[model samples]
Target: MSSLSPTSPPPAQSHALLSYPSPSILLVTLNRPLAMNALPFQAHWDLSELWSWFDDSPTLLVAILTGAGSAFCAGQDLKEVQANRLQPPSQPYLKGRPPSGFGGMSQRKGRKPIIAAVNGVAFGGGFEMCLNCDIVIASPRAQFALPEARRGLYASAGGLPRLVHGAGIQIASEIALTGRSISAEEGIRWLFVNRISKSQETLLEEAITLGREIARLSPDAVIATRGGLRDAHEMAGLEETWARTKERYEKKLYGAPNMLEGLAAFMGKREPKWVVSNL
Candidate 1:
């Protein structure tokens, strides 16, 4: 069942809304509809801390990040930043802290998978956050862009690396250089978006359903699988990557309780009860 957090309440309704919509799924919503769910200073800090909470929570196995109202997110609150500073606020990256970038997930290194439910305009940091997700589901009306170039700024919140990694260097360069918004169809064509929903409401529903399905898997196996995939992506040599994948499977996934449970369940024609743990 869905439940909102009351003990660790967010700053304001305009900042964000955190809720547990299922047994193991966390739904994070950027709540500033009037501001297109822009990330103000407090919102940024809250998101940073919220990721930590999700990491520690044994109940939360998946996260669905989305925005309220018509827009997914319009990136930073420019008006709020302009009122206090001459330039955009500094990246939230600290010298020694958990690696959570803009909106708390961009540069984060963790096992839990996050799915971006892009309901509307996702510009600059918002687009960066979408890139940070393991999967992205966007509405037909949703648009994405790294418009920092147009504003004489740069995407410093893991946008460059994530974009280049997902969309290739050439497309990443063009998007960053032109600051042009990509339609949901174009995003799908470019392989940036996993799928496009008919509308925002359907987008969230699909994302939640997806998150629930993922949450049902063995948590430790999921963690190991995600880490192994990331390592393979970063490895240069094919032989070395294969060796590493084999080693990871043997050490982390193979012969584990979860693996045995799966085999037993299949043989017995029953559902497996997985023990959740992080390796």
Candidate 2:
């Protein structure tokens, strides 16, 4: 239940968004309720900093991102964009433009897991942000859409690509082309969301539970497993990928302190103490 103020320290801000640290999880919130937790120019930068902070934090094994108010995020602040003051070439919109991808979601390569707790509507870039998460849990009122198509643009910041990869090309095409929203139920049905909860509190509780479970595992094993999956997806053929994986497994992760701890804990009937180390 410990909380950190928005303007507390480095990588922290005084705005609506806040970052709170738990034992093994970092909870980041979009705190602008008046604007439905919309992403302002500075908010994007804050997000990038948040991701970077999490990447270097060894105690933080997982992160849970959610909105402060009822709405998760209405997407980019169109007012700022229209005024020509939103885009920062420096941050690259925190996307994969030059530095990181949009909101730092698309280009992040951290080993820690991220879970998106969709409290309400996740539209346009908001939906794209959810797509970047490793897992998504939504409230029953949560709705997802890529409405950029209707506005003469497209959800290019990993939305189209991730949707196609997660929910299949045909379904992603339908959603993008039609600019229609899908309910939490429909999202769960399509496997786009892992779970639908009764409320935001419940959704976050479940996400934190999952995060703690992940934290209990050996950190090295978790990171290596994520790398293996990413490699398998990027490369062709399982033969070559598995060969490379075996080499890394033997030469690196296996026989590590965590592995020995796991074995000893099993033999001694005690809880395993996972040794955290930077990879």
Give TM per candidate.
0.86, 0.87
- The residue pairs found clashing in candidate 1 are none
Compared with the true structure, model 2 gives a TM-score of 0.87
For model 1, how does the per-residue alpha-carbon lDDT over 63-107 read when each residue is reduced to its tens digit? 899988999899888787775466443564322223577777678
List per-prediction Cα lDDT, in the order shown. Answer: 0.79, 0.75
Q: Report the lDDT tens digits of candidate 2 across residue range 1-279.
A: 112222224386534455454476778787877888777667666677778777666666678988887898888877767655545446554332324455667556656678898999999888988887888999989999999989999887767877887789888988899999899998987778998876766887887788878777777787778767766855678998888767766566777788888899999999888766446
Give me the runs in candidate 1 sitting further than 4 Å from their true place: 1-14, 86-99, 240-249
Candidate 1 local lDDT, residue 275: 69
The model with the greatest TM-score is 2
Error of 1 at 80 (Å): 2.6
Which candidate number has the best lDDT? 1
Error of 2 at 236 (Å): 4.2
Judge candidate 1 at residue 4 and give its lDDT.
25
Task: RMSD for all candidates, in order, please.
Answer: 4.0, 3.9
